[model samples]
Target: MTLAVPSSAVAVPSLRVLPLRPGALLLELVGLEETLSLYDAFQQSPVAGVLEIVPAARTLMIAYDPLSLDQAELLQAVAARLGKKRSVGVTETVDIPVHYDGEDIADVAELLGCSTSEVVRRHTEAEYTVAFTGFAPGFAYLSAPGAELAVPRRKSPRTVVPAGSVGLAGEFSGVYPKASPGGWQLIGRTPLAMFDLARDPATLLRPGLRVRFHDIARSSMHAVEKTAVVAKPRAGVPSDIGNGIEILSSGLPVLMQDLGRAHMAAQGVSLSGALDHGNFKLANRIVGNRPGTPALEIAPAGFSFKAIGRGVVAFTGAPAATSVTSANGDVASVDFNTPIALDDGDVVALQSPLSGTRSYLAMRGGFVVEPVLGSVATDTLAQIGAVALGAGTQLAVNSENVKKPVLPGEQPAFAMPKADEIVTLDIYLGPRTDWFTNEAVESFLSQSWRVTPQSSRVGIRLSGEPLERLDRNELPSEATLRGALQVPASGQPVLFLSDHPLTGGYPVIANVAAHHLDLAGQIPVGAHIRFNALNAFTHIDFVASDPQ
Candidate 1:
């Protein structure tokens, strides 16, 4: 069926284009319908240099290669595609059997001024359209026209929302793909596995699809549970290991990371990779491994491993004390950013880094871990890709990517910031800078925000003077980038890292400069960060060209 432009929408809705970074732009539309229409148009006619397009509630984030396309040309290309009549392909209709027995059903009923049964009736009766997928893999936001079931989110979000949970927030309803932290008001649950890597499509729901909820008894829910398919583990290392590493101890689970799954934002997958990209690359280069070769991303807590056969290895990133012990009991200290030769039965151990949060260990041939969705990156937030490394995990090595000679005297791009130091990062104001008050914006740039212990690969949580905001309205979820300084209602800003959710609802006052993203990722907990704005906030105005 053709997706008709809503009667309320003008022929040419002005687009508010804002710079997200050096190579990305966020285009704000009037509403979801207009956003979807523009997305469809882009799909029909691809734009040059636009690597990926992540569509959200009312905006589209375009990530491009700056060398291939300039901002002005990209803006003109987007303007030319605007206001075009496009057809949406026919999508499948999926029926989910839901048991209307959530913990918040009664509270939702009271808020809507309706009985619990009425709440279930209205929800089951409405046919919803999947507007977009985000927050997590396979988690789709469903929208129904003229639906009066709108409700506000919970006052305080739950620490863990169970998988298969059906929830509603604002004007949309969705099912939780997996158990994770959430703030939505849940009304029910479904037995269907919303996301299963074993399945061909992986995700049960996607944008433009039709969804219907069927009320079912709790006992009958088991019948549909079989549809939930669990992913099988990849092929294990051969018993007769010729060359590999045996993890003797992993204090904090180590993750296999490469450059991450790119061009996958449309499916709600984050660009998760090594937090410190420069260090990750340096480690790989030192060991003579090809770029993007899978390597071990170690936390500051430290880990130890044993070599099964001869190979070359290198450690980079954090300034950690490392040493290798041979079977003869001879111990030799290792230096950061230097190649180390590993012999059979050699035990290598790394102590907690004196500075920074993560380190990288790269083997000459790269670890033989299987890739998920075309990458070996493990997204902690999305809970996908390679599994975390633990004690007793044996990783095989292959010489498929050993292309260059090991470089022994390589140096890191920058020094890791110590916990007591105050690191200054360059930022460009934008997409939602106006959401905060002038004082808040000024304070954000001038204040020294302390990085709290609540930091992770997902983001670096900062605590400082609460940034005052002028707009208290709930911002619809939009595409987020690494190093986005997102301010929530509490006035605290979270600097998103590699594993940040693809879409976020908080307002992003600024984004760290591209050159400084790796540095931002290495900031230690208890450290202080002072932001320096490269340019003041400015809006981009573009007039739509004739569709004809």
Candidate 2:
């Protein structure tokens, strides 16, 4: 006889719903099993405007479009789904071959007060299921309930953990798909390719999949290893497109970006796109290209490009002084926000911006490149999308068919942000504020924090008096978003940026307000920032009629 799983009606009451961002909500559930059950139910009957449903250890992050669905209706739909009786589906079991020798093998065994042999036996004996995938593509979080291998993460995380290293921490086991910073205790190493973009599914593991580890002799580790599947060549990027720009010299960092990829977050892809959206859109509009067209996100200063064909070019953001020199030696100064005509072989040079950190350059037609997962945005952290621009890189532009733009008589002007200025950002506290002491919360709001040089597209490290946490427990991995003010063990806060990680273990005491996201992007290094809390009720868009 087939065994029947219990209904989730009793479990539904245990959920704590919290509003996250503009159109997202966080549903804190009891266990990984219930989280997976709700995930399955939502997939069966998805609500309108619900783009992606991401599951974590004990939370479900639901991303929706506010224009199509109201926040209250979305909550009602999800609550109804959880109220129904649903059966957990059959799970696929995968066996991973691992060599027993690792750097932390003896350390882990000593901490658990057991022999190294017993540690390996316990790990292999238990059946672990994949709880979720995050941090990086194909990085799955595995858990074995009612197991005896619970342990604490290292006091300090390694700067770089080698790929294929098997690790364990706090009832969880995972293999690093790529080399990255991690704190999990190393138990062994696996030669299996956990993540390969060339494969049909890309990721080797997914939520709800069963995993088992088998012991393999060190001698056979290389013999049994499988090579990554070869990827098919992508189309759309031609070697010698007629209307294209050849890079003579580029600034320190230049990347191709669009509006970013939002629907692919469940696959561990971040929404890495243009940092300053207001300037990116204005640049495209001035050049008569589509608003979501891929453009060059040039860093402040030292960007020069030669036009291969006659096209209209416009630059916005940072108010950089520009100069255009034609092949005939005729030179003209270009004004910001106004479209400039570029002849064949005309060279354009942009100096350092008087203010601001990033600028956008868009042509009459958008840049044509092979898109990965429906976006041209380059994510430096996740290493997705187009490669970074270099001095000799050739870029193809779709200037052959330019669309006529409808413009107002007066050009729209945007003010640039001044460097070394104190900027106040609106934030919403909670989701983890109870973990901090009252004094810590006050320090977070009143103190003026300086942006550290270590800040990047992933996150901004703030320097200030460390906020004290009342609780000393290790935070479980949970869904994180851009603008999350995550506080680590050292009490320092990290403000997440566009290419931030999908999930993190640090407690996020506050999130930057939705309206201030673009402004947050332009915050330069050495700038001072103060976060002010906004009323929580203002974030939700309540519908006039509630769903029955």
Candidate 3:
């Protein structure tokens, strides 16, 4: 069923509502002005059930708790705020010194039919406002009103764009925060750090701020050297100095994870926590640690650690071959999902998982690690929070987050799918489902997609029949969520995981149901998946009427 807007409310830049999921909705607007205006209104007076509002170039994604509000109520609340005056707040202007000696400077000038000096002049003269932050932490998309410095992205993106490189693409300009792959047209490089965790806010730019670029000489650039800053554990937390765990060998990088940072999507931060949320909580519960207590999220296989002092620990998630060695060199196999007492000289080792991909280890207290932005979860893409664990890494534990005593006996374990197994996951179609043809949607539900080995905490990249698109135009980047099946131009859909990016330009066909997300995360690489649609595709259209 489609929700239609009132005919009397038709006006310029009409509003349309699209169902993103059961708990989320995407509001389609005309441009940045309409998007930001509504964003400011929601910020000034927030709705009751609205958990987050992520603004983009032409859309606003709103996520809420289904228990607190329904879709019809949310639509009415949003309609009431339309055409409301935006309250202006004090805006800060940041000045960045740039060296205009980029490799693309000449190319950009030639494309604009102007001289290199004119290109530099045009960039430095116009004032740009921070439209939205995405792609990466501290990477803010800047918009310049009435400026003619627009350019297209390169045909092929560079594998490694230098950090702090100023670039322009389409109608926006931005800086690369930490040197990842990019396709923007580089015009210059900046000495100022775009993102620093040591700072109070971490990111240098935010929404509604003004930015100015100044041309600098080559000789002046030598004074400022780019350096990487690591986030340390917050001060004032009590620690057990002598009692700790020391890593002997880690086949893959083990990371500390909790519930993850919330309400930070406005800064391009994703909700990066343990991939298996159910097991993460169960591990902490068995170890008597409170919810949100930091724990070790180990990858499938070869991990060994030694106890510096007496403690209790529990292993959960994927089933693995685990054993413990005593000080006198006696070794004994151990069972999982149960608490094990450890001595000072005891060494515990884990082999490759028999089924799943990730395992969780929880201590009686919790891992003593410094958190970045109130979360211990490491965001691999954004490079935020705790550092990855490797050989020789030592972690302290304390009772600060303990709530109860350790539980006795073993917890029943569920069967995890093996590599050759085929699992079925439920999905809800929407938001961008109309972009695909009916045949494509049917094929998506019928065909079996293999979980490629290229998958990671960021997303589960699938290999299957390419789902053809009905509309192949470039989609403006909009907010994304965990479990979203984002279909790129390659026709393959990437199921976003816990560490997925906040926004993307690809169209999402469906979203995995929330109840089955934990199971989806545990599917081993090479396993096949069949999608079951819970409902048919429905388009929701909403136009604001006179509030009086």
Among all candidates shown, the one with the greatest lDDT? 1
Candidate 2 structure quality by residue, lDDT tens digits, 421-445: 8899998886677689989999999
**Candidate 3 backbone clash number:** 1
Off by over 4 Å in 3: 1-12, 223-228, 232-241, 409-414, 544-548
Determine the C-alpha RMSD for candidate 2 after optimal superposition of all C-alphas: 5.2
Candidate 2 lands at a TM-score of 0.89
On residues 76-131, what C-alpha lDDT tens digit does candidate 1 reach at each position? 68766777765756768999999999989999999999999999999999999888
Where is model 3 poorest over a 10-residue stretch in terms of lDDT? Answer: 1-10
> In model 3, what are the clashing residue pairs, if there are any?
233-370
Q: CA lDDT, every prediction?
A: 0.86, 0.79, 0.85
Tell me the lDDT of candidate 3. Answer: 0.85
lDDT of 3 by residue, 161-209 (tens): 9998999888898998888899999998888888887786888998878
lDDT of 1 at 239: 56
Query: Order of all candidates by TM-score, from best down to worst?
Result: 3, 1, 2
